[model samples]
Target: MTAAGGGAAGEVDEGPLDEIDRLDAAAYEAFMSEVYDALGGRGRDLPARELHGGLVEARGAVHRAALTAEDVATVLDGSLVEAIESVGRLQTQLGAVGFTLAREAAVRGLHRDVALSLTDWLRVRCPWLSTQEAAQITEVVKACDSPVTAQIGDAVRDGTVPLHRAALVARTMSRLEGSLDVDQREAYAEIATRAAGRRDLADKDLARVCHQLVEDLLHEAAPGERERAAQELRSVTTRRVGPGLTRVTIDAPDGVAATINGVLTSSLAAPAPVKDEQGQVLEPDTRSPAQRRFDALATTIQRGVGRPGAPPSTARATVLLMIPFDPAGGVPSGPATTAAGDYVAPRQAAEVACSADVTPVWLSADGAPLALGRDARYATPAQWKALAVRDGGCSFPGCSALPQWCDTHHLDHWARGGHTDVARMALLCGRHHTHVHQHDLTATVSGGTVTWHV
Candidate 1:
């Protein structure tokens, strides 16, 4: 039959694909019924070996049919939401077909020897698939090993839900293996399947719901069992990826989770952008909440590291940066890099250095002390406090940088007769400080407000 209810030998389906994709409910139901039949049928009583070849051909046909879908520059008929639903249906169908093939191949013991492992066979047959993708299929096969989960296997094959959601069901059931009785787990599997069937269920939400179900099941368990399960759930692991980057994972309980959330929320409470005296953004903060959360973690770690209340052995991690100062003046000639290869602005490094215990080392060209670790250019503690209180934050009019982030700037370039006194001081954050010196911004201090005459 033709696409337009005509006889065969006519043209294939044509027109705006976007329009064709949103066929009425009756037509869609009929088309899905035909697809269901193909998914269930084994072609013409083929021998077991040839059946694999038939399965490959069927997969290719489905792939090609999906590829025929045309992307429209603009929606002409149905809404984009419906188009998205159609894509989901197609993907679920494809996943079901692939999982079924894996289960069949494994069950039939096709080349199930050590020399040509299942992984090897999958790599050869599904050449485009990654190792992880093949491993997921292996997991699905193992999950279906039980007669109890037979319904989940069937639902997955018939595209009642997606592979990821099915995988969640499988994994959740596995976690309950030694904990719950077989009957309890089988009952939970039904909940997983029903939840997975929802069109709007995202993978995260699916995992969340499955996890809650497990927790609910455990709620009725003996106190000792509950405590053991809670103990087993706690974990903290860190894997170093690079010179200074580490990925940390935590399975924190309610109290710890709340503590982390509170710290991060406080970290993000202030306005984001660092501004210049001209009310221009000195640094734009475009980081998302997730990214900001990591930054907050870093900030919290830095703040707590080797502090007063820490263990006696945690005296401090000594950090000494030998920043090159321009001989003509004390201005930093370039960037300052930490021992761990983290490049930081001179002003920002100075802020960290302000709090850290420092034994400054200065060497002349002849390896002599430039001045016994004392530079006349360095501001006194009193001077720093006066600057902080007077300027409030970055002296830039609209900048909301906290005092901790602000650096005391010389109203007159220190290279050109600026004194290290309160009258000669202004406060600016790292970016604005760089801008002021680099662009030679004109400046003045009157009362508590420091004005910049660019």
Candidate 2:
């Protein structure tokens, strides 16, 4: 055929771009057919990665040609349910690929192109899908062709697992191999599901167990090797030390001998005491006793301060301490005495008594009590109840996590200006709390809505 435009008279009218688009559409159809056939029969026949890659490429072409800013805007403005259904139908017919994969590819470009956030997009377009489900679907598609991804899709289709659980399985499986036979894979998959169900199990523990299962299947090691691996695994699983009760001793730099109990071994440090102008001990710096204890523990851990190379006999005592605020702003109570001279207050004494990791002892400055180990001032049951009521759930916006699943988060931060009052605190799930601190997402509560300023 003769070339048409931008050429001699004999040239054909069609452009290369038009031809390429036509061919891409046809190729995409064929790819879809193959994927459908593979899923209908044994899904193992096709390489998931190759199929996913093709689908993604096809989606790019279709998205460029068929979807428009106007269409997206109209859809977002109109009924989200209708828009999602329409999109789902269009994506479903795009070829014979799995519905999960097709929907993922269709939305992939939309996430970047659409003005509204993808989460919002899903709400408008696929109102039938829960946020958790949408997140899981996205996670699986992003991890295409992996055994875990496949498993997640399978679970969704079978309705045996929730989206979150499926996502966890996919993540765990991605670290493993598809070479595992059906029986072995099923075993590990079941284990993964069970682990996901148990909220108390650490994610690392789940991954480790799944990894061990895969290793057992792939390595086929001798009994000795297996035993060694088991031992190492056990070591990792078991806590190196227990909480609540332990003994630790701090060797003062001056060797004057001060003992405290319920002291955190990790928080023992030998920072030089600040002295006054007259060679008398000035007020210890403003660091909280808790902060000092943590610093001491960190120092011991890093420098191996008091821990001897050889083992010792008797365990050290635990000491507890607390700071009490009087109704007036004046120096409330020192370690040595209250107005009664029977040792500061019962609350402070209790703190000293309960500091279990070491024997209970009070640290005094010139025979005046300074600090005692005790429970945090604000962790009362009533305060926690108020926090739960105010926050409703995990206070992170868009997160509907339950109360039991959350931890109290200080609004201004206790280390900063945040107080222990309920109004200045909110509940956040462990994951979101970690994300807040780790990713530096600024979370603040105003008018009862927790806003995240990333």
Candidate 3:
């Protein structure tokens, strides 16, 4: 099949080709020959029905041949990976043909003549196609027929782009109708065409790119439109897979996703060993990453719901959120990045900061710390280390919560005529801290030991 730039699909353009380019040309030639041989060089000369029937026959022949693992080892020069790729490539090309045909059917008004909706009409001939798949094809054809995505459609027809990639580009472009300018639309379509030629990217990776691109564009939409679009996309669903197993699926915009992931990841800790009353070694915790995440989420939810014994916060105080701000430009800089390098929208980051006990660190253009904002009353790292060593754990009587799980509480009440000093502070779990405040309990520190009077 011909590519968009007057060359065979996968052929290198005229240039001083590198070794990788030469390898790509050789591989493409081999792939083309393999595809041609697989089709018996009929070259679309036969009727559509006959060609399809021949394809089915060929598939049956391969199935009946019943090539074993040993035969696979002996076949060609080595393994069956090449066979898989050849078949997979042909499958992708044939799938693109269906989309091309759908576009033609749409333009000819065949669905109208049959008095069926385009989706139903397409599904009538291809009963295996799901309702969603049929609707997607109809949408793709409509988008391709439009002037905005005409070039993308042409690439799909010429076998330069896969149908699935075209579908993603079409869906994204359709949502961005009024939001994008002519140049933007053209550039986006061109990008999609180029992305289609990237054989290295899997469909899922390409889908992510499409989603991110659409999200960035959505940010530029008219006021309230971006929020509306985001709200429409956000969803959560739960289903019971078995008696004791449940599956929860969450879909959200990037900002919300980032926050949720941050909260979950921050809550995660290595499972402690189950100990006997003597504090002797016992069975080690054996939770998988997914199980740990589930526990963290459950714990977070319990705290959010004001459960009696739940901690107010599970995240560490040291989590750094790096979001660029431009005071001079007075415009949004870019997405915020978490300590874990996950991206969060700046607006969401600001929302998080509103209620969070955040200590902002101002930085210069070169990222040197200019100042720490309002941290005089907070514990320093050295102070925290000293307290952790001194307290051994939460200072509340009979509480086994570790220092990492506790916060520094001022025994003399920092808000009520008390100074910030290690001598007057004790490590307390969230529940006990709240309890102490509610009951006006007193604590005495002597010889680096704390005694709480309930």
Q: Which candidate is the best by TM-score?
A: 1
lDDT of 2 by residue, 322-355 (tens): 3342323222234433333355453333233322
lDDT of 1 by residue, 1-454 (tens): 4657464666665556656488899988777678667878453345765857867886787666443336544565666668677777877887887888889988887734312346556776788877656666666676789977766778889889777777768766766666776788788888888898887887788889987986785687788887655544566757578998888877665667788888778845434888898989989888877788778877888887635432211123366555444567555555655556667675544333332233333334444444322234555556766777887777764455667776666676543455667887777776566656655576877876788875
Local distance difference test, each candidate: 0.66, 0.52, 0.68
lDDT comparing candidate 3 with the true structure = 0.68
Model 3: per-residue lDDT, tens digit, 333-440? 456566688876754543332212544343445666544434555666667667889998778765556887777776764323456688988887655665565456
TM-score, ranked from best to worst: 1, 3, 2
In model 2, the runs with Cα more than 4 Å from the true position are: 1-91, 94-128, 131-376, 439-441
Candidate 1: global Cα-lDDT? 0.66
Provide the TM-score for each candidate, comma-separated: 0.40, 0.32, 0.39
Predictions: Cα RMSD each: 22.7, 23.4, 26.5
Task: At residue 443, give the lDDT of candidate 2.
Answer: 65
Which prediction has more favorable TM-score, 1 or 3? 1
Residue-level error in angstroms, candidate 1, position 90? 2.6
Clashing pairs in 3: none
The lowest-lDDT stretch of 10 consecutive residues in candidate 1 is: 308-317
Query: Residue 59: error of model 2 in Å?
Result: 16
